[model samples]
Target: MSRRAAASILVLTVVVATAIGACSTAPLDVGSSDTSPTSVPLPDGPRTARLPSADPIPVSPTPTPQLPVTVTTADNRRVTITDVSRIVALDRYGTYGTAVFALGLGRNLVGRDIATKFPAAASIPVVTTGGTDANAEAIIALRPTVVLTDASLPSANVLTGQLTAAGIPVVTGSAGRTVAGTDAQLRAVATALGIPAAGDALVARTDSQIAAARAMVPRDADRPRIAFVYARGTGLLILGGPGSGADSLIDTVGGQDAGTAAGLTDAFTSLTSEGLIKSRPDVLLMMTDGLASVGGVDGLEKIPGVSETPAGRDRRIIDMDDGELLSFGARTGDVAVALARTLFGRP
Candidate 1:
């Protein structure tokens, strides 16, 4: 069998394993009794609701198209594009597609990765499944003139080679999870789509929004020490230390990462019950699916050592959609602000 087939089988195996594990665990009714905090009080004052960062940035009335453009990708590969039509972005975080939409070229998207669920882009035909696995045949069927992706795509080189052989320009951008990394990704996608100026404008707007959100965080507020736990029923992964998108999000919202404080250095690691208890996180951050998989806050508390932590005892958990939580793309600033509001109350 080909490497592509092998990779697909491997991913399928992992997905099946996770599903089996979930089946063995007790199911939580989707509409079961709610234990999570329903309404966090807003700060005492009238404050304007900030616009969502995902909103399109206003560009020139007539966007100047730069064709036959050559640009260097995050992988240091130089690729030239002759056409800006029929684009596909297969990045796991769907940042490229978001950048394209932000650049006012959403209509040109012929296909999207599974993670691209934002407005306009959400309706595009998905060319990948199981998060980042590219369906080569499906992608080819889309007849995308250019493809933008990240290094995380399974069998990236093989996929890119296949597309290149078929006369499509495949450009890979940085998958950095930090703010600066996000900026670089936006610029890279823009350059690949031949709209460097639009990228610059979007980045500036994003940075400004981030700054505004940061300003809303109360200086005197009690910033919670937080831990982001990735759970799929019995399968649990702890997002710890620096470099992880969870760390970036926690920092952006003015919260401390308890995992980092406990000296866990990798992007993700299995946590011991004792280690988790000792970390002493005041709040737990989780993806919505992960939270549901463990039967919500009640089920999460049943995990060893979790109930002992201040977070579990108080049931202080913040959950976001798995994709949006980590995408770190155009909506990152808005996400940070939303998370901040949840933690310290809205302003």
Candidate 2:
């Protein structure tokens, strides 16, 4: 397929179309694999492997397809989705917001986080700061038809109650939380919005990109040691442990997580500069703004013992967008590709 054709499909159906600047060429060579649902044969109790019949059995043509209907959420209230025209996605999780955009729902979004920077989401209004913490008043003021949020969203029940009282539907999921789970969440959300087919296609595209990147990294080599550093105020780094999004991303890209070395938990643990130096990670991954705010590479090297660490010696520190790198949602596939490239140097 040609790039023009692919772009048209994305624009018409993929929701958040990636801006590739319009130089006409072949469509993304992600290469299609068969995804058509296969027919399953019935049990051998019935006649099996019968020869093609000359006379076909008469059957009903079909039943009228059901139109989009209201799905009552877990809170026990009915909210209809006949047609999703206007959406106010107060998604604090970057990937959830990005997934909405990717599903071609960007035009429907009325609110977003300050950290959201997807070109498709640029015109959408910012309503809240990005993170697990959400602003209910700011979100409600937007008057959205539907709201998409993460599973770990702080005050999730409170926000859902508020939205329900206001008659707005809320959809929450763990999709932007891990690679596999995130994929499943996307499918569920799309299906709920009456677009299961579209959701499947979007996942196919992203999954292909991730698979391509993963294929480049050899499974046999020792995993590269990676550390995630989040600046928490002054002189504090919130390090991610097992079960956190950071750990999932590192493992996906065949990198060993620094937190795992210390047997950390899913919650962020404070790490001293001395501890980081002791970890001596091969790659130091951090959110871009946070890394720059504390004086960039030079400042990082100045930390006690950091100057002697392998990461500092080789200057392997990599800064990434906070939302995309950390949000574990639709953009995670893209994140995986970026990390893979950084680790493998573009084979």
Candidate 3:
């Protein structure tokens, strides 16, 4: 109550507060947040004291990533497509199916033209009874996500419109005689399938092989005169123009077509056996595929005036696969070189 007594009490209170603050300043035990009395390792008594063990970090299931399918076109167009699980290939060029096989996407095809000969397409459904006579009803019924169509068809306009209306993407291409153009067409197909690099690689490989075959032929030659005799029954011999596949093959193997003299700019005139004998070809070529149909060389010779011709007399007729030799798609150089060997002993 007195001033001196109160001052002594305040000093006592300050000393007590300071002492309490100093006691609170002691360092904390980081392992335990609890303010309980620290315990030294004591031997287990009635109730055994056990340390906690970490539950094996519940191993999380790993996630797997899926790959997206993409295709790149020749014109540098990129298209991202999905659910491309089914495909149908319909066209005059059976080589298109061969080209698809070359791209390594043959397994994706569910249907093909009747003429498809590639091993992969053997088990696949056939959409037609004949080569170019594919039925649109069957093709549409297959319900493929994509259809590879040959631009070589005269009816491509009608076919494309129908396919588009049915919600199918129709990819078009021309089977080129030259490797350069053929590869470009393959690239377009690859792009549509979302595997551009694969298409490019296939084209490169095929072109290289064809180039190797062509390289085997020596340019130095007398340019032997050659003639492609398309024997329709007896007297019907359909010759090609300068730009035809037959023309390309003749040039590649160092020979000239017998009909080149006629100067028929397009596919033309049925050369009679009389005319063929008058023209006198150094080498006469006919497609091997048609040999059975043409009834072989004896059959060819028996064609009224063929035996009198120099080609038949000398036994110089060469036969090869018509599609492989003439399609000018993948095997142009192969057939050309084969013909070259028959005439000039090369490749």
Which one wins on TM-score? 1
Considering lDDT, where higher is better, how would the candidates rank from best to worst? 1, 2, 3
lDDT of 3: 0.52
- Clash pairs detected, candidate 1: none
lDDT of 1 by residue, 102-128 (tens): 678877889987767756666789888
What tens-digit string does per-residue lDDT give for candidate 2 at 1-347? 23222211111111011211111122333776644433211111101111112111111122121337565443455556655565655444555566666666555567766445556567877665433346777777877767765444456688777777887777655433567776676676666566666677667866765675566565435566778767633475566566556787888776778877766644466667666766667777777666766687777767665567666677777766555566555566666766665565542
Q: In model 2, which runs have C-alpha deviations exceeding 4 angstroms?
A: 1-67, 70-79, 129-133, 232-234
Report clashes for each candidate as comma-separated counts.
Answer: 0, 8, 2
Each model's lDDT comes to 0.67, 0.57, 0.52
**Candidate 1: what lDDT?**
0.67
Best by lDDT: 1
lDDT pick, better of 1 and 2: 1
Worst lDDT run of 10 residues, candidate 1, spans: 15-24
Our model 1 lands, by Cα RMSD against the true structure, at 11.8
Ranking by TM-score: 1, 2, 3
